[model samples]
Target chain A: MPPPPLPIAPPDTDPPGIDQQTLLAALRARVARLEGAGREGHGAAPIPVCEGLGLSGGGLARAALHEILAAEPGCGAAFAAMLLGRAGGTVLWIGAGAEALTAWPPGLARFGLLPANLILLRAAQWSDALWAMEEALRCPAVAGVLLAPDWAGDPAAQALDLTASRRLQLAAEAGGGIGLLLRPDMAEPPPSVAASRWRIAAQNAAGAGQGIGDPCWRLELLRQRGGRPGGPWTVTWRAAAGQIDRESEALEAESA
Target chain B: MTAPRRYLALHLPAFATDRLRRAEPDLPQDVPLAIWASQGPRRLLSAVDLRAWAAGLRPGQALADAQAIAPDLLLRPADPEGDLRLLEGLALWARRYTPLAALDAPDGLLLDITGCDHLWGGEAALLAEAQERLWRAGFAVRGAVAGAAATAGALARAHGDGPVAPSGAEAEWVGPLSIAPALRLDPALLEQLGGLGLMTVADLLRLPRPGLARRFGVDLLDRLDALAGRRHAPLRPVLSPPDLGAARDLVEPIITRTAIDALLDRLLDQLCAKLRAAGRGARQVVLMAWRVDGAVQEVAIGTGTPLRAPAHLRHLFRDRLERLEPGLGFERMALEARVTEPMSGGLQSALAIGGRRDEAAAQLLAQLLDRLRQRVKVRRLAPRDGHWPERSVAALPLLAPMPEMPVGWVRPDAPVLLLRRPQPIEVVALLPDDPPALLRWRNRPHPVLRAEGPRRLEPEWWRGPGVARDYHQVALASGARLWLFRAGPPEAARWMLHGHLP
Candidate 1:
């Protein structure tokens, strides 16, 4: 049989000045750009948070899955709520079992997430919760999807494999929305395909003669796919300001 | 002026027996079947099948006598309710012949086929088609058409079958029918008339008017006049003519999901076209599939807002289509808009730049929510009117407009997670009303480093008297904040863990 023709241009047919390698590289780059544009129309802009937290792009990337783990008991939910509020569109909060019934509207409003912009979905099973999360993430009408699957009772069901997370990531990319997976800190976390991972711990904000102050958290950046991971920074959630403020700066301002 | 009114009446002679046969088609046809009813001391046959009728069995005959006559007679207790229900169902099914169909009680249906006859060619053709369809459906139907409902009904019941009586010929058509059975006269009156040799309706019509009035009551004259087309007989149709509905009868029964989906698409297109023309939208739509085995499977879907888009409506029905059980396939399907509301065209102010985008986004969100609702429960949270933590927020329907947050009611320091039910915790405090210094919850101990107030909240008076709860916000040794409450007096204090504050 005759040899199959080359899929691309033959060496002899290449332009005099431009080599095949350079041309191929340029073509590949263009194709990548086009594919990215097709998946995310107009490209999704990253959501900027406080500057000192050290996200390489100056913010959390959109159309990507981010894992938030609670080093303490309850800080992960708070952090996820703050991020959802910042995204500023319809947020689908999906949870399973008892975790589904824990979202308080008043508390959500404290983080600048209003009741009108939030849609709460409660699934009884972890699989259903994950499915709902993926579906919500794929809808362009939604701004973000927050899934907190409780598999504490079933040891076999606790791990969400890499394939499942990758599917969610792809769906998020197609929809141009953020995907936040909130979970409790595990002794040895299962393998994941998340773009970034963070650990949040509650910080005491009360001082002498001062009652309970605004919630403060110590946020630790544990992993970042293509950027430097640097955190363990203390920040106070100033509800009145509708943003997070550095703990030292906030305290100094309060005293001054 | 409108053309003279016409009605077609159908009579089912063996309705009770036929209903059972239709329900259980495996029943033996050669055997003599009878439906018996208890009358005081004796059980009498209320209805008998064709075979039983041929064997000289009759209604109102004693069951013992019937058994003696046919020894192998099949008997079933008469169900008057089931018989009437079947009759009503037949009346609804008869709507395929005309828009206005009404029940003629026990075992008959009346269709006001005034102008509808032309659709099936003519009155005779329409009657023949109706009878043919009914016969194919396992019914022995005798039908007649005349200028008046009373005349048609009387002729159908008396003559067993007849041709259409042209306009102004009701009297001639009913003249030859026996007066006693045809006009449905009282037994005593029938006996008296029989004694006087007045057997046929023509003979009674020939008698003097005054003497007939003096002898019989006004009801007798009323019946005669109605039959003669001198008085109008009104009918209450089973369905109003203006109801938005579309139905298709399949030549070959279909069982595959693809076929059903195609049929649904066509029906939805037809229904949505009607809705668009009427400048209205449906709020609730019902889809009914009639199985060949005489069973009907119905599924209904309701929309949060008026909708007429076929694609959107089809999407809403996609999930519910699986619920339809197509046993032995379906021969007929019907789609009806049970509830409707007037709808205007498109989004308002579509010409404007921002308004158009906003409207499109709102529509997209509504559609997304509708799709989510099919697989999961989607709800929007709203501030509720209550001081208790559990009652402070309410879950509203996804489409409901968000109500304004109640003023001065929400606490800025409310917990991020409020347990649906408070969990009891072991607490150690310097005083009963003070914040917990140490707490143990879920078999875990937490030492409180700093504490907040004992904000006392008294139970609402309308909720009946209850102990005031002293609530405290405390920071645990691990930096997690918890909402704790103590109830009852100092000596009998009970501590409960209520919420997790961020």
Candidate 2:
């Protein structure tokens, strides 16, 4: 919650003679205080702050990097759309290289995101993709950025090191847009400055052994800044609504 | 009233040789190089370098004779067309000094620098600047400014180099110059004048006009009057292209990144202020850094929205700064807004609850698009004036709104992600008319928890592929509700998955 301790390396000072960072920090603190007082300044940030855990009542902080680890092929994208969709802003989906399909993958509205509002950007190169994603996050109009770079072929570019995440975080903060990085891995993710990290896997819903029931997935909260960090919870991935539902009668959540 | 016109004649001596030397710096300097032209029965040298002239090989010499004098003489065929094009290009660039520039053909540019000279700190400074630029551009030039185009051209060709003849000085300006170029006479007339031993322009002025006209025709007297400021013949200057941007030239070339950044800040302030004054906004900014070595480094930045604020423009330029390929050191910098839009409603609106949110979303998306161009292709869906399920609506680009649709029309509830091609699935039904009880897809069975649809749609002959389909919205045991359709007759019906209902 206190930000996993600042990195070992001290914050690098700003360029010589232009000490804007100090002023910037002071302004940020003042803004936070003003927001705390329930008074928004002119041109309020596009992305609203999150209440907690999921993307409801402000699902994710504006311009924050959120990594979703997916064990299954399509679950991470589906989950990302589900969250950003509910946040109700323009959505940008960036897929780097030919690894991504041409068409928009299914299940955007199932989580409450409008399919029409989704803007799909196909990047020819990984660097272009990363740059565009960061640029999008820095724009006030964009609500979310979903970056899916080519991880298998170009790990050097795909690796979301802490520094890269920090850069994305800075861009996101500038425009008050949310950033979501979807990677395919069930294990602990590499070090990153993302505010929230999740792991997801598609699983059989109860009694969905032969016949498909409500879509169920193993949803794990690997790291959340202010949330239950430990989780292997089974939640029904409502295919149509694009939300994680855990109801007693319809959902029946189970411990993974 | 029309702006008063003053002419500056730019004489590019050795234009071909100088241009070729600049293009091929590795050329042998010691060799006598000449641009040759075929004149009827023999190949004659049209232009020769100093080395060739020093070897007693003058222009118009037979190519064989020149080669005999300097056995290793380098003779390149002259390219008159390319030379003319280069002259025209320089005329265009002269706009940096004045708005009116004209080509004198062969190897000269004439500029009307009547009022613009003050901007460069006076006439001398302006002439000095033009001369310095041409020298830097690898041309050996003779420039002279005068009230008359003919006087300026004569002075530039004969006696003056970077000389300025003030107003009403055209007659005196040509007095001390040579007769050959001052008269601009044909070779035959010049030879006739030489027979009389009249070589100086003053000698030509001393001759009676009636005698000169009887000997040299009316053109000779007419040209002499134009050169002496007795008559005014307007120069047909090439249309001056508009320069709607600002540029800054440094006293000393700069190579350091910090200096460039500081320079950029000043330039952005200037450019954005200009845009703001015009009630216009710029979408793209092109930064060109003219290096000391005569090279130009250019970088262009595009913004998602019309930008009038210097800070945002600076931010956009920051990302593209890496693209500037500065060679040596930069001596001049220019900022131009290549694309512009009228600033709409002052760039900001009252922060309405929904409007702010939409603006923010649009801004973010636009920013992303600006960085990664051609990446996002939004297929916009809009209601069309049709009745068929597929034809009733149209998918277009987001920028184009759909036309009016039929009244009381509403888009039916459908899956957000629809399969463009319906995938086949095995279905089991209790009765031919009843909804499917179960279906199998991807080799997995889906038990029908509920069946809701049989919304029958008939084929429309007006639309092609006019096949009928019995559409159904079925709830599966997997909790995934799908949009399905049956094609062909009931006796041999086939079911396919069309989409999923959210």
Question: By DockQ, who's the top model here?
Answer: 1
| Candidates, DockQ | 0.38, 0.14
Encode model 1's per-residue lDDT on B1-502: one tens digit a residue. 9999999998887788888998888999899999999999999998999999999999989999999999999999988898887787777677676768999888888999988888779898989988887887788889899999988988888887656888799899899999865788767889998999999888888888778988987788888888888899779987666459898989999999999999999999999999989988887888978777555667888775678889989988997899999978998899989888887894421112112246665666666666666666677777887867776777776566677888965587687777777877899887665688888865788888877878887887799988888888988877888888888877888988888888
Extract clashing residue pairs from model 1. Answer: none
**Docking outcome class, model 1:** acceptable
TM-score of 1: 0.71
TM-score of 2: 0.60
The CA-based lDDT of model 2 is what?
Answer: 0.69
lDDT of 2 at B450: 65
Query: In model 2 chain B, where is the ten-residue run with the lowest total lDDT?
Result: B348-357
For model 1, state the Cα shift of residue A184 in Å.
Answer: 5.3
lDDT of each model, Cα atoms only?
0.80, 0.69
lDDT, model 1, position B34: 94
The 10-residue segment of model 2 chain A with minimum total lDDT is: A35-44
Native-to-model Cα distance after best TM-score fit, residue A14 in candidate 2, in Å: 46
Cα shift from native, residue B356, model 2 (Å) = 2.4
